[model samples]
Target: MSEKMQLVIDGDSVAFKQSAGFEFRLNLSEFPDLVKAHLAKVKPTANTKSTQACESLGAEVLEKDFEWEFLKPFIRDVCRWGGFALIYAKVLNEK
Candidate 1:
């Protein structure tokens, strides 16, 4: 049997099963902090000043943008489908 987890965001509930070879857990309550950090890193445009600040903070502007773009579609698909099929598809495509 697979381990399952549930996450609730903004009153919407999502349940996910642990994917093969990837077993971990998340504390949903920390999601806000996670979002704050992600936003802080990715929200700014890639300017010389911003890039320097990001580098000093050990944050890579290009990398953050790339990661955000990569996850955006999956997030949209998950919200639209209300299931893990999109996630499975993404994982399958990566292999």
Candidate 2:
């Protein structure tokens, strides 16, 4: 699907354009800082152990990049629609 979304940043605008080739592009060279600020507003929540809520929200946020703000939402959307799971597993250390 080909779609275009416009985002206003720093009194300027960025055109987010996607094509059928699975290519996504952001055109806002004039205000990268604005983009960064916008992205920072969507930070991930702290790790949790609950199952139900964790699974739901995790699935929503997992497919996104940890640092790249402009690309995280789209990635997360694709992952969720694709039925991908997000896990937060960690090992413990013995003293």
Top-scoring candidate (lDDT): 1
Tell me the deviation in Å of residue 75 in model 2.
7.0
1-95 per-residue lDDT for model 1 (tens digits): 75655443334333344445443445667677987786577433322233234343333434566475555443444333333444655654563
Candidate 2 deviant stretches above 4 angstroms: 1-27, 47-95
User: Which prediction has the highest TM-score against the true structure?
Assistant: 1
Clashing pairs in 1: none
Least well predicted 10-residue stretch by lDDT in candidate 1: 43-52
**Residue 70 CA displacement from its true place in model 1, Å:** 21
lDDT, candidate 2, 1-95, per-residue tens: 53664433433334443444344344456366765774566444342222334355555455553444633443444344333424111111110
TM-score of each: 0.28, 0.22
Residue 10 accuracy (lDDT) in model 2:
36
